[model samples]
Target: MFFDGTLWRDDAMIREGLGQTTGARMGHMSMCGREGSIAAHQFVLGRKVYIHMNNTNPVLRGCMPDQVGAWVINRHYYQHSIPMTDAAYMSRVGDPALRRT
Candidate 1:
């Protein structure tokens, strides 16, 4: 699936201090560099969302639009449950400093 000198990422090689690699051989993931590189300031905030997904993954895609909506609601409900569980644990905590936390 590779051709000589074609689709060569010269910038990546230069960034990695690797002169220039060409032809047939593919570069390793270590040399692939980071994804979504952007500067962050107070007014210009940026972050990375780490999610494990695959092209062939059948999650919610098989479901209807109504089913997807229901799934989202359920997901949100479950996410909110974490705070309730934490509050319940804090209520049962005998330590004042921990409770204050």
Candidate 2:
């Protein structure tokens, strides 16, 4: 597993308790669980795999030219879509009782 020791580096908790190695302390915890204690990385090692991804959108990390091209070709890759056709049909012919849906 990749141990990113710097993800929570210089965070508030580390500065407050651990004296601002950030989580740069000799023994710190994970950013989520223990609040940036470095020792947390110890458990992250070994056979287990840490995906090492953030909760944010991966696309924001800077997409490649080919990735953008493929996205243009296969628009469905982004499933976050609004069914305008269905909405229009409903607006014209749907029951008012079901409009609350």
Candidate 3:
């Protein structure tokens, strides 16, 4: 699920750009212009739980956390899986060049 105003909002847009009807599933995805966008948070959490549950990696690695207090204080689910920094998580997932080796 992509947030409004993000580069690619949904699978239809992605499919149109790539000109393909079928492809790998982009589970629990989001892109926001600013940090802690509420829309982004909602999109990630509101989607089917199974998508996130099945993936081994941190689903919200690149996305920002909700409002400072709300994220931690309210006890939103999957809080533990959020990455400290996008760079660190991306590295752990492996660089594209490294993966090609």
TM-score attained by model 1: 0.38
Question: What is the C-alpha local distance difference test score of candidate 1?
Answer: 0.42
lDDT of 1 at 4: 18
Q: Write model 3 residue lDDT over 1-101, tens digit each, in one string.
A: 43322222234335445534322244333332343234436545545222222112233335456633333453344444465464466677657986444
Cα lDDT tens digits, model 2, 1-101, are 53432234435344445344544354433444454434456466465322222223233248778855654544453233447666777788657888657
Candidate 3, position 51, lDDT:
26
lDDT of 2 at 97: 83
lDDT string, candidate 1, 2-82, tens digits: 111212232544444554553124432221224211211223444432122111223334767896676567557756788
- RMSD of each candidate? 18.5, 13.2, 13.5
The most accurate candidate by lDDT is 2
Candidate 3: worst-modelled 10 consecutive residues by lDDT: 48-57
Clashes of each: 0, 7, 0
How do the predictions measure up, each by TM-score? 0.38, 0.22, 0.19
What's the lDDT for all of these models?
A: 0.42, 0.45, 0.38
Better of 2 and 3 by TM-score: 2
Model 1 weakest lDDT span, ten residues long = 1-10
Model 1: how far residue 9 lies from native, Å: 30
Candidate 3's C-alpha runs over 4 A off are 1-7, 12-15, 19-24, 32-38, 42-101
